[model samples]
Target chain A: MNFIDFIQAITEYDFLQKALVTSVMVGIICGVIGCFIILRGMSLMGDAISHAVLPGVAISYLLGINFFIGAVATGLLTALGIGFVSQNSRIKNDTAIGILFTSAFALGIILISFLRSSSDLYHILFGNVLAVRPSDMWMTLVIGIIVLGAIYLFYKELLVTSFDPTMAAAYGLSTRLVHYLLMTMLTLVTVASLQTVGIILVVAMLITPAATAYLLTNRLSRMIFLSAGFGTLSSIIGLYFSFTYNLSSGASIVLVATALFALVFIFSPRHGLLRKWKSPKKELTT
Target chain B: MYAVEVEGLSVSYFETTALEQLSARFTMGQLVGIIGPNGAGKSTFIKAIMGLIPSEATTITLLGLSAKEARTRVAYVPQRSTIDWDFPIRVLDAVLIGCYPKLGLFKRPRKQHRQLAMSCLERVGMQDYANRQIGELSGGQQQRVFLARALAQEAELLLLDEPFVGVDAGSERVIIDLLRTLRDEGKTIVVVHHDLSKAADYFDTLLLLNRRMIAVGSPADVLHAKTIEGAYGNPLAFLQKVEVSS
Candidate 1:
């Protein structure tokens, strides 16, 4: 179908409308939280939490409860496990992340093998955005609002702790509490994006758009807005491509986001490779 | 009342003793420089007192209050290397973080907070660079930004870790002058310094540390040969250097 037909198709089908709304909501929330994750050098931690939610999803399926509660529980468990292992022993943080996420992911695969509804597992691994229900869309919207609201409420605390925890503590703010709060927000955002991006591709939604905005902006607030803009735009474009070519929705979205990152990486005014190449003397001065 | 009082502050990392049974006291309005050799626990001492590191102290009080309660009235400028300068933030936003604790959890900074941050920036001569990206600054300028943030805290006690390291002469002079002004205004300042020769001239009091309190007194009394030898064994070389410089 052509562009006009695609637009018409979206309006005609409720499933398409739900898919479009869910993707945009997922993009905006992921983009917002991803800025903090990348700034705090927790990109690997984000990857670990996203992958680690698999076991929770499987358990939630077996127990017949909401997947979000299970996923959030497992995500928090992974975060705490990584923290405990790294903090209590000689093991570094990245090493702890690697150990926990791999094991958790492996356990999830094993758990899924024992389940009767294994076909449902396939959709969870690789998202089927077109099959998203209206209820799922509402859930995503509610979770998105909660995550964004928490970030807004704790913006200063998060900023101070991430920048300099020492100063944060000296100022009477609990740095540890802020750390856990951030991890909790990350968990919520990860769970919210699971249906739209799947387990494996959610980290891209969290990192790529924010990283792209990081290249273009000098302020965190600006980076957040720009990141959300890029995320929403990517979701729209990727959803269009998916509808037109029958592509995997999650992969298409990630690819579009990555392409945007590449464009900014080479063309951003102050930090871009192309800008440096154009003015070597100015680069040296900076 | 003394600005700081500690009976026995001990800290250990893994199996290594960082600071052992350190005891010291300082009066208010003193610019105290903590000078010690490498691995001598200068940073550890500051971090321990600030409760940044795990430590066991019998009695550690600041401004006659418990350490935890007194922290609200304290400002800390950590070492330059502890921060990620490439993280996307403006100079003004970074300084505005000082008001976060005052604003508590939900309340955002108002116009008055921004004006205070701007005034702090002006004190450090960083007002011109307030709109610039933090990563775009030089090392000295970045240090100044950190100092500006501490100034914005408006605390009664200030702890600075290696504020002069890698700083340009102009920035160094500006920082020293600002610190002295703060001291003159009845704010207690403690600086972690490395240069022994300049320590005598920079601080009104000297804290010679080597995993313990070697000496705590006027610069003239603490910079003597015996105390230098005690803190840093066989201190003939350092003593002669200090003697010649003085």
Candidate 2:
């Protein structure tokens, strides 16, 4: 199918429209939340939480309930568990994340094996946005609103806490509370994106666009806007290519984001590789 | 009135005691310097007072209110190294964080807050660099931006931990001058300083600590040879050199 054909299909098919809207929403919230993740050096946590949601998804499938509730439950449990282990023991945060996520992922695999008749496992693992149901679409939309709304309402708290938690504490802000809040939001975003990008590729969606935006801008607000724009564009373009060439939707979207990241990596004016080579002297003069 | 009052304050980390039975009071409108040898719990003292760390204190008050209640009336300037200078934020926006306590939750900065932040930046002579990224500034300039942020907090009591370390002499001069100015404005200012040579010139009162409070008095009284030797563990050769130069 060509670009024209893709557009025509989107207008004709409800499933295509749902896929487009859901993927785009996932793209946006992931970008926004990913900014905080990267800024706080919690990219690994994002990956861990995304993977840990699998057990929840599996359990939700087994219970014949909405996967959103199950995924979120497991995701949040993993996040809190990671925080607990790291905070209480000598083991570091990354180590805790490594231990918990793998265990949860393994349990998820075991649970899914028991539900052999649910052939959508491959779709869940690799994403099949073309098969997104209306419920999933609405879930993504609701998650998008909550995530964005929370961010907008608490931008100041988030900014201060991320940049300097010590200062935030001095001013009577609970850094730990803000951290947990971000973690809850991360779990929500992860669950919402499962239908569009799948469990395996959701982390790439979370980190890449924000990191690309990081290389381009010097301000958090600008970085967030730029990241959301990049994520949304990647989703749209990736969907177009996926529909046109029979490619995996999640892989195509992740590849597009990676390509955008590479472009910014080489050509970003401030921290770019190409700029470093082009004008070392210009930097000294400036 | 006392700006800060602490009684029976003790802080320990695991097995080691950082501060032992410390009781002290800082009066209002004084520029006080906490001078201590290494491992004297200078930073720990500040952190404890700000409630940044766990400690045991029989009573701790700021501006006649409990530490928790008076947090809104207090401003803190943490060590420069504690902050991630590479954070993607502009100078002006960073200063705006000082206004967050007043804004409470769910409200963004308004026009007046921006004006206040800009004026605070101007006070620190960083108005020209308002739009500059934080990572782009020099150590002193960055420190000044932090100071501007504390100023924007509009607090009655200011607590600073080592605002002068790794700073250029010019920046040091600006900071000391600004602290003096703030002191003159009837705000109580406390600084954790490393350089003993500048302590006499910088602070109205000097606190000498070595895991315990050695002395707290006017610089003339606290700079005594015996007191200095007691806190610093056998007056080093530099003490003589400094004494000779003076």
Candidate 3:
């Protein structure tokens, strides 16, 4: 369809409208906080929390509650449990996250099958942004505001804690508090985005912009803003592409972020592969 | 008054006692050096005092408060092992982490904070490298960055874990001068030091520990052959022979 036709279709169709707005909000949330996760080497934490929420949502659905609430609950429990368990179990953070996530996912699969709502589970995994109701949209916005505020109120702490928790702890900043808070935010953001982007694609949104921005900047503040901007831009462009090609908008947004990352990885002036690969003579001459 | 006081402090790994009932006190304006055999709780003593390790109650305290409460007043310059130097932050940014507790969240650094951090860097002779990524710096340069960070903290007490390892003599001289200057400014500095030869030259007090407090007093008294032998649990003759033969 043409641009005018596409705009008309988005305006006329509730599903398209929901997808667009939710995508932007998710973009903003993921973009800012993704920088935190990437800096802390907790990209896998996002994956872990997402899968861990499955069992909660499945059980809640079996009991007939709000799927999002169940997800948020499950995600927080898993995140906090992993946080405390990792400390006592002698397993590395990522390894603990891996173990917890897989178990939660397995339990979720079993529960969903038992509940006779595996199709709904499929929606949570692959997502159906088109089906987001007005209330769910509101929930996504609330979580977005929360994610944004948490990042803002805790920016300095998050920056230091993410890069060096030991120093943050030494500064009396309660590095553990910041860690748990970030996990809680991740829980909310993952649950909010689950309806629009699915579990697998959430990792892409949460990681791509930050990873791309890391290649281009050394300053933490710059990385956060640039990642957010890149995330929004990629979401919009990807939405347009998906609309035109009749593809999955969620996957399209992820692809756009991936494509941007590839470009930045090559062309970013600060630490780009090409820039680093330049010979010493070439650099000196330039 | 003691700037730092540790009593019956102990730390351990799964099967190792890094520190055992180690106790010491650091007074204001005192430069103290800690020397012991490897795995003899040199770094662990510092970590326990900094509350970086899980320790028993009443183990470590600073300025009469618990370590957590007094953390801001007690700056830590951790060993190179504790930092991932490959992180993509500039020297200035890394140094500025020292002032993070003061800055808190939701606020960026102001001119005063930057000035303090830059001044710290200047004291370490690394003012020009404020914008350079930390990973690009040499070992000495990295140590300077940590020194800059400690200086930026403006703490009453500074705890360092191996501040002189891998640094050249020139950088080492600069660090020693800075430490002396900080002491003159009425700060207490405790360093987990190697190099037994420089003990007298660098510090006013010496703490010789081998998983316990072997000696604690003026370097002249604590650096005696008997004290060294006691701390190492070996004869001074053997140590001297090893030193000369090397």
lDDT for each of the candidates?
Answer: 0.89, 0.90, 0.82
Give the winner by lDDT.
2
Candidate 3 residue lDDT tens string, B1-246: 678788888788887877777778877789999988888888877777777778764556688778878877888887776676656688998998888877766678888899999999998999999998887777888899999998888888888889898787788999999999989988888999877877878999989888878899998888777888887766573357447735
Across B146-220, the per-residue lDDT of candidate 1 in tens digits comes to: 998888888899999999988888889999999999999999999999888888789999999999889999999
Better of 1 and 2 by lDDT: 2
Instruction: Write one digit per residue (lDDT tens) for candidate 1, span A11-87.
Output: 89989999999999999999999998998899999999998898998899889999888898998899999999999
lDDT of 2 by residue, A1-286 (tens): 6788889999999988998999999999999999999999999999999888888988988899987889889998998899899988889989999999999998988888887545667777789999898888988999999999999998988899999999899989999999989999999999888888888899999999999999999999999999999999899999999888989999999999999999999999898999888877333111
Q: Report the number of backbone clashes for model 3.
A: 0
Q: What order do you get sorting by lDDT, best first? A: 2, 1, 3
Model 1, backbone clash pairs (residues 3+ apart or across chains), number: 0
In candidate 3 the C-alpha lDDT for residue B185 amounts to 88
TM-scores, each model vs. reference: 0.97, 0.96, 0.91
In terms of lDDT, the poorest run of 10 residues in model 1 chain B is: B234-243
Ranking by TM-score: 1, 2, 3
Report the candidate with higher TM-score, 1 versus 2.
Answer: 1
TM-score, candidate 3, first chain: 0.91
Per-residue lDDT of candidate 2, residues B39-155 (tens digit): 899999999988889999998889999889999999999998888877899999999999999999988899999999999998889999999998888889999999999999999
